[model samples]
Target: MIKFNQLRKVFDDGTVALDGVTIKVEQGEFVVVLGPSGSGKTTLLRSVNGLVSPTSGNVRVNDVEVCEQSLRMVRRKVGMIFQQFNLVGNLSVINNVLTGSFSTYNKWYSNLYIFSKELRIRALAVLDRVGLLDKAYQRTDELSGGQQQRVGIARALMQQPDVLLADEPIASLDPMIAYNILSLLREISAEDKITVLCSLHQVDFAMHFAQRIVGLSEGKVVMDEPQKDLTAEYIRKIYKTHDKGLFFGPESKPYSDDQLVTWSEYK
Candidate 1:
């Protein structure tokens, strides 16, 4: 459903975020992007929906060139979740979710403020799916962090996007809350058959949830493997030693570099 070929993202300040990276994601797959703080994971996720355009290379989703076409339309097919739940604090939960369907409204005639009854119905349904139906009428700022995050998910689901890009979706939450959110996302993907691509800080969480893993370091893909085939030692090389849980550590296993890499999958 999504493909990136020779993808390179270079900022105006000469920082190359991504370099010659290539990845293909199938429909209905749950993939995790694992990396350290400045390892280009966010850049890759933003590029899928044209939030961050590639300096060179191509990003195609559902056969549409993300860099070439109108970003307004591309974003409709790609939904992004940020580490911070980017909710409008003053707006009601239902109204925030309503923003996702803004594209369907006739912008020429409406100021994107006047929502139809049908739109409201759909927004409520999405809120229910995220377990936030009761909070629909409440101000977003009044809710807990976890509830606010659920609202964010509801907003994304309202778009009916085919591919979901989560940029450190669990970074802001506690461990239990983060697990619940991950489980919610995975369940929704399984039931809806949507492609789920997420960047994660916790290695154990990714291993437990993601079907496949893509590890990045210094703007390059160093490890890409099915979760079952992955080992702590192999994950170590993806990021430098500073990345603890990702490599062999107290939580991870004692991995060694001698374990042969699965090169056939890359081929």
Candidate 2:
């Protein structure tokens, strides 16, 4: 349902965020992107919704290329979750979720933040799905970190998107809260058949939740494997020694340079 062909992103400052990367994600598949800082994970995710245009190559969602002309259509089919829980502090939780429905309204109504009864009902349903129904009338700022992220999920669901893109959704929460959030995402994907492409820093969480894992380093894909074929040692090889902190401990088996596989091999 999503495809990236030879994608490359080069900023004016000469930083190449994505380097000839290519990847395909099937419908309803939960794929996790694993990468450290500056590995192009966020750039790749943002590219899907045209938030970041590629310098060359292309990104396609549901067979439609994500260009300036197709951005509105592509965004309608894609829901995004951020690590920062992007929400207006003063807005009510329901009001925040209502923003996702702006595309469905006329410009005047949308500009006035005037939602129809049907849209309000739908927003409430999505809030309920995220276990935030009671808090819908409360201010978003009063919620806990985990609760705020749940609100973020509810807001995304209000779009009724076919694909969900979560960029480090669990990066800020505590371990248990993160686990619960991941669990909720996994359950939603399984029940709704939403194709989820999420970027994560935790190897163990990705291994437990993702059907397939795509590892990146220095703006290139270093590993792409199904859960059954992904060994801890193989994943350890994807990260350089200095970069391997919590993912790999000192007792883990070391890998030789010859054993490493390049992105070209995947082609």
Q: Tell me, by lDDT, which candidate is best.
A: 2
Residue-pair clash count for candidate 1? 0
Compared with the true structure, the alpha-carbon lDDT of candidate 1 equals 0.83
Please, what are the lDDT tens digits per residue for candidate 2 over residues 25-50?
A: 98888999988788889999999999
Candidate 1, 1-267: lDDT as tens digits = 889999999999999999988999998899999888899999999889888888999898987888654677778878877889998899989988988776667774335457888888999999999999999999999998888889999989988999999999999998788889999999988899999999996667777788999988888988889976666554666656734433333454434544323322212
Q: Tell me how many residue pairs clash in candidate 2.
A: 0
Off-target runs (Cα >4 Å) in candidate 2 are 242-245, 248-267
What is the model-wide C-alpha lDDT for candidate 2? 0.85
